[model samples]
Target: MRTRPVLKATEPWEKLVWWPKVMYEEGRYRLWYEAVPPDHWDPEIGPKLAWPNPVFAGLLCYAESEDGFTWTKPELGIGSWDGSNETNISLGRETVGPMGLHGASPFMDPDAPPEARYKMFWYGDATPDVVKAARRERPDAIDPRTTDESHVRAMYVGTSPDGLNWIVQDKPAVVFSSDTLQVVEWDALRKQYVWYGRGWSWGRRTITRAETTDFSRWPLPQDVLTASPINPEQTDLYTNGKTRYPGDPTTHLMFPTLYDRATDQTTIGMATSVDGVAWNWTPGNPVLPVGSPEGVDAGSMFVGIGLVPLPGDRIGLPYAGYSYPHKFPANLADSGFSWCTWTRGRLAGVHAQTEGEFRTPPVRLAGSGLRVNCRVQSGGSLRVGVTDEEWSEIPGLGVSDCQPITGDQLDATVRWSGGSKLPVDRAVSLHFSLRTASVFGFEILDER
Candidate 1:
């Protein structure tokens, strides 16, 4: 899906803006992004502060919008810049102390008290004691050159009554440097806090996972998704843009940015998992490819951390776009924020050109009716049937009894001439037949 640019770099402090974390709450959309000041990369002064160290590079800023399309950066007078507290900066060198803010992932804690309603996990410099302990425990994980005052980094936790102001903890949450956006979510089903971030495997960057019952203490991460032999030879997974489908907890989705070392470019790919840990790449990789050579996002792009549900039954995925290669000089790169959308529940589909049929594994019926998300071309049609565990067609629920679905609909009820009602207490399987049609997904509906 191609993106439509919505936010751009306008303020002097926002010479380069990216890494967006968007949330929808209280009928308003809030966005937190990484904004880099020009001085951070200026040759004369950049070297003085060890600028561009992956962990201590940018400022965390805020923006908002009534609708997801248009956004506004409000001046909160929170973080002072150029001797004035007139910018929308939320966390910077002054607020976050010496570590500074690099990549911030903020989420609403449903289980927390009002005072700690909002929580954030960010990457920043590690204190001397924390760095020393990490090196002593896990020597291979810590970078060799990292010292007490230098490139040593770790993940930190903070809380906020509101989304703007924050209270950071004194110690680091995880001692290893994930060097990318660290995503954390409260898994209500598992009743634990789940984290996804960067890890190394086969000498390349890969997505890692960790879980804990307590949010304050996190274990060392383990690589969960890595570059497989099927991927291109010189490619690696850079960032894990992990999110769960709205209104559904069974499906976990990720849009990881694939970095191509040969061309020094990056693109987005799609993956899905049932339990958030074991993931499989969806067919037709590079779901969101870069634009033409002269286009604004030709060089590289990184999808953000959330999948927002917009009006008109659409899903918007936020991203950052750049006009220069991933390794291009920061001083000359052009970057901004934008979003791409897909039809609600249509991120992946099973298609048939001439004719095709497939049967789902046995599932216990929990609802009364079946509703499908599909599109049938002019000369095509789709039908659904029910089968027992032994692959025998159930009476009154065979394909021949089903009314042919002939039009595109986001949620079309599957009907059968015999009856639309289904048995809810027995195990059954669904069989789908299509001709020149595509089926995105199906849901068991409870008519009661």
Candidate 2:
């Protein structure tokens, strides 16, 4: 993976910019990130005001890019900072109350009306009245940790037309402090909104999930992904960057920031799931490992929510990097946004060092042809054939008749001596044979 810094802390209100939520729409890349004013963590005042305290929470800022690499923080003139409205601040404490936006995850709601095309799920200070009502009516939904006479924090749902101006719901959606990136997506299959956030498991941070049919009402999040026995006691998963693979929405992917309390450091980890609730860690994790001791991302890193499709058939994953430990004083820490990319549809692969073969389960061949993303090294090759439901090889489509696939290609056509055409709309299984090669994934193509 290749990584490069895209945005730096240049503006006055962007001293600790992080928690990037990016999107690609209308042929442009739009980014919304959390920006903290430098003074929020002042040496003297910082000691008194606890981190994440409502007194000085971070602001939600905006930026855009024609190409995912170069970004511009256009002055939106929407929110004021130090009596100046010429800032790129998209949402600030003034709009979302004293407790500013925390882990604001935004997505385009395809099912919503034009005026409410964009929606966000975030945690912030809940009004006193809302807190009181929640305690009285739905005490089970409130997080006990946030109970304080001064104020209470809760998750909120907000909508926007253009993603810049937002209409936040007056009441809290889920009365809990999901302090990590609150990822929400419209689960088209279930016809509901699914949310993934931070939850406590075994006294450590874990990824939680919740579903709701209505955007305004959400149940208390339940722990879905947690640390296993393999993990050290002091290690936990934080910031659930849950997202669907752009190339295949049916596959759920997460780039959870693995937090090590023992070292006070964090690194990005990969997880995969067929259903959003159940998850498994991807092998050889910490995919985007930390840098050298003195490097920018040495202390911690968190992957953004979206996987951006870039030029050159690559997919970019945006992330924020800190130069100091996660618990380091914000005033003394340096952070910025960067993105790393992988060859499109090649984030992970199935490898075979020796001669190996496998057959997929029966699937309806809706497309006319099969294309595969794979790489075959020298002295290695791959062959794909088709089989009937009963494991019988189709005539003229056996392994021997298959054309050998060699070299590297993102979408190589699988062909046979007889014909490359497939039995469209027929239930069949794909048989793959490999020798010292790797198969990333396969796609059904409409073109024969």
Candidate 3:
């Protein structure tokens, strides 16, 4: 048996930072992480500042390293569209909107019409009410840990002709609200502009995919990755936010979220996708585990969206380090810091030998109640065909959502089928077909 590799947290960086983004640029690695003062960032209420808690805003810090391993914090100065902080907003720059600015995802356009080569999209609110709400909510009025949604923010975009000069767009790019961990990439293989972000639902998060011919406008939303709540093996696969790995489908690697329930620790994990949307987990999906159990980063760490590739082709990731005491007083917020990590070599991928096998049950008699359970092992849409004694596809039964649950154990139940309220009990085979899971064939279960 192969031994479980031990990739412990090494030196040169602190832990428990929130929203770590990595990127590769100019034959070197650059990282951007979010950090606030430890005492100011109330753990009970998270990065969001509660009432009278003395909340300090978030900042985008810069760090550069020769090797991806060791990093040196450099001065990029405060937020700037240009090298100078003239056009940028300062700390505590509050807008009357949802929430204040958080970490931003950076994208470089080498072929950007010779005008602008860099763009950044971030989560924030320009609404006045949100800004007021941010100031109103306090530990003095209510419990700091309460979940309040009075102030919701939208995702906004900014552009830079060079890394130094940036200009915030007059209008927002996406209208949805939630703290965003975004990755903007131009895929040469698919020739599409891919934006990866997570949609919050069901006390968890799911990966959402949207494509655009141009970066200016986006179409309707679709679920590229759904949340797998009941699956224990997939417990760590929480947020589907950013992907820092370089390369297209074949060598593409992504940095995702992994929250351990055993200790309520949040950190980044690793996974890979082929077509830039659908993802498959490599062995031990939680690649970068929690920080040291007894160190500065011992609490939890979220992700940021920039990954700089270093000279030797190593990858540098900038992340925020957070420290929230498990057992703490009610009003005190969690503490946080900024740090980074670098990775080398090609990440792992999921192995599929024979694809997958899907089968729909036999036909049933008319007016008989029916429920279908088509479980898919791999992550893909499962289609079941219900024949009307003569064999035909039932309209609604053909709906997709029965995506495989990692190992394919998803069950779907439907009412009457065969164009009537009836039970299927005929000698018809249950033929299962899969779309977008993998390059494989389905199996046939002969009618009973």
Candidate 4:
């Protein structure tokens, strides 16, 4: 399928909708996002500290839709700092940081028996006390000398019987100096509840993952993937790293790479994998290329958060829509929420569509033995000729100018290299090539 940008967020009032999740039980979709109020920041602290500004903190809001198209905001007003919502207030509203219950990934727990309940993994900041306590236990691991201020960032775990009231876990599931992003329920094959978060590396941004069988007793981290260039000493290769994946019955992560064309920034390339660890990136340039009417990702738009895998193998992307720096400015970033959807064609089977061959530098049919080499992807016909010109028009070869060699499935490629006797005239360059009429999500062979 050809990929396209899905949703574009372009207004502060509209920040209420994003990071969509499908509710299988009700056959609907839900977006659990943070609402940034107008004039919420205090200019005294500094421009960078505008968000987490304390005046207008994150209010975990919900929006729902039956068809995943149109949506309606439900006015529940259930969130409170004292944990007074009728739904189980697992986590306290009095967040350790300025914002509590920011960007969270919600899902119906598959590990829980049929009657257990739904779950949500919320990612936001922790209180300074909570941050210090966590760091004190790892004094050797935590360098207090580092004044990155991010040391206060921490992630808390939350849950709900219904989607409304919540229970904030007394202890957090994952905590790191930098801000955390999202989490998902690992599939049965993984046997763990995994959370994807972002943090600082020395002084730059990077993504990391940590998991556990039960929310508690969580392990530190095993490298899932790194964004650093092969040679970090060289400044040309680095990415503003982030990782997001689906957490439900099945699991997949969206791995993106930045293509900084400087003035003309490139589209964020993407890759998918069943497990979070071993990623199988798409081949060629990118799964999705740049040059579109969608909003530009200047200095802001920390978009590219999640995706909705459609029924017919299509994907609906939801992204932040605005023109950089101003899009997410300190106190007025709310004027940047708009959305768009991408629908793609899905290809199923593979069949040899067509094939042809030609010879260069004229050759004689009289004493020159012909050597034909071929490369095939998705398996296609190999056409060989005895002369510098195409000879499929001549008789007795048994194979047509184009013949079937392979079909559409996953990815199958084969190369043919053989020789035939021919009369000689002059040395000629054999033209062996591959052609396909079908487009596949994956490819198998390359000339080199």
Worst 10 residues of 1 by lDDT: 47-56
TM-score, cand. 3: 0.56
Predicted structure 4: lDDT: 0.43
Off by over 4 Å in 4: 1-26, 42-57, 80-98, 113-116, 135-151, 178-180, 228-251, 257-266, 284-306, 309-313, 325-434, 439-448
Candidate 1 clashing pairs?
none
RMSD of 1: 2.3
Q: Residue-wise lDDT of candidate 4 within 1-448, one digit each (tens)?
A: 3223233333343332233334434566666555543323435532443344443344555666665556656556454432334321223244323344555656667566543356666555555566566666644333244354443544556566776666566665545443333555554676777766554454544455677788643545543544434313321211212333223433364534343434323333444566666654444323333323443433333333445555443445554433434213434322232232333322122223474433445443333333222224554444433223543323322233323334432333322233223334344333333355333222212222
- Candidate 2 local lDDT, 259-304, one digit each (tens): 8898888878788998887899888777787867776788888778
| lDDT by residue for model 3 (1-448), tens | 1011111122122112345455555556555554433334445644455323222234444555555556665434444322354322222232212133554666776667645677766666445554344336422322232244454455566666754445666455655543446667776667777777665545555666677756754443455655333335434444454554544335555666666566667666665666676776555545555566555345655555654444443444544444453323312433343334433333442223445444445544343333333333444454444444455645444423222223232123332233433224454444445544321222223322
Query: Where is model 3 more than 4 Å wrong at Cα?
Result: 1-17, 37-57, 69-99, 128-150, 227-241, 244-250, 305-319, 325-346, 349-448
lDDT of residue 212 for candidate 4: 74
Clash pairs, model 2 backbone: none
Weakest ten-residue segment in model 2 by summed lDDT: 47-56
Q: RMSD for all candidates, in order, please.
A: 2.3, 2.1, 14.5, 11.6
